[model samples]
Target: MTDSLGQQKPVNIKALLQACRSKEETFKALVTLSKTLPRLSAEKKTEENKVKGCESAVWLVVEESHGIRHFKADSDAKLMRGVLVAILSLVEGKMLADIQKMDLKAELAELNLSSYLTSSRTNGVLAILNKINTV
Candidate 1:
């Protein structure tokens, strides 16, 4: 898969899962990627759209253009922001069918996010997936 920037993007789920498994590298990668994402606007993030069950308030907005989905998200907590970035990096610019087919629970487990995350944060991850499904 390729992005709007003409860069070849990782489409294989296993490769992305492996990338997220490296704690140090994935953390750095997330932070760097987050810096490049467009900032979420206040209008784009309404109370109703805020991800529920999250320890920190998180907002995710999904937009589809030319048959590809693009995600933009923000969070009050830095770590949550990194987690969102990591997840979004894997999904964004992909077809909805591909996103829907992904085994997110297994992928998260492979990344060991469940072990590192709190119960609320784990729920927040599910909430993100729910939102994606809705889109």
Candidate 2:
């Protein structure tokens, strides 16, 4: 496969986030992030709100307040939930124009998160962002 591709992808050497962080810290942050998730009732977890490309069950809901978009997202996977929180935290109170202009890849990468995500998870992030932009 590498011979066909011509070159192997350069491996990133960053420590996995889950490895560096304590389980207690992870649990606490997850609890806080989940508690802060914009209210998505159980009834709202229908196919219409689910992010299509995510391997995990991710549901997103948006409300526009005076041109600012407030996004509420949830995922069954703990990792995905954290990703949602990281992305949503940026645009939560910002204007739509700001959200559109935001470089989430750079932002997430700077936080050393991009290295931890698998290709599918990265795709899921894109899907989540696309849903935000379109809606």
- Predicted candidate 1, C-alpha RMSD: 3.6
On residues 16-111, what C-alpha lDDT tens digit does candidate 2 reach at each position?
233436555545544444544444689878899999998889999887879867676778887677667667765666687787798867766744
* Clash totals for all candidate models: 0, 0
Q: Provide the clash count, candidate 2.
A: 0
- Cα deviation at 112, candidate 2, in Å, is 1.4
lDDT of 1 at 105: 73
lDDT of 1 by residue, 29-49 (tens): 546544545567889789866
lDDT of 2 at 16: 27
Against the unseen true structure, what C-alpha lDDT does each candidate score? Answer: 0.70, 0.65
Model 1, clash count? 0
Residue 39 in candidate 2 has what lDDT? Answer: 47
Q: Which runs of model 2 end up more than 4 angstroms from their true locations?
A: 1-39
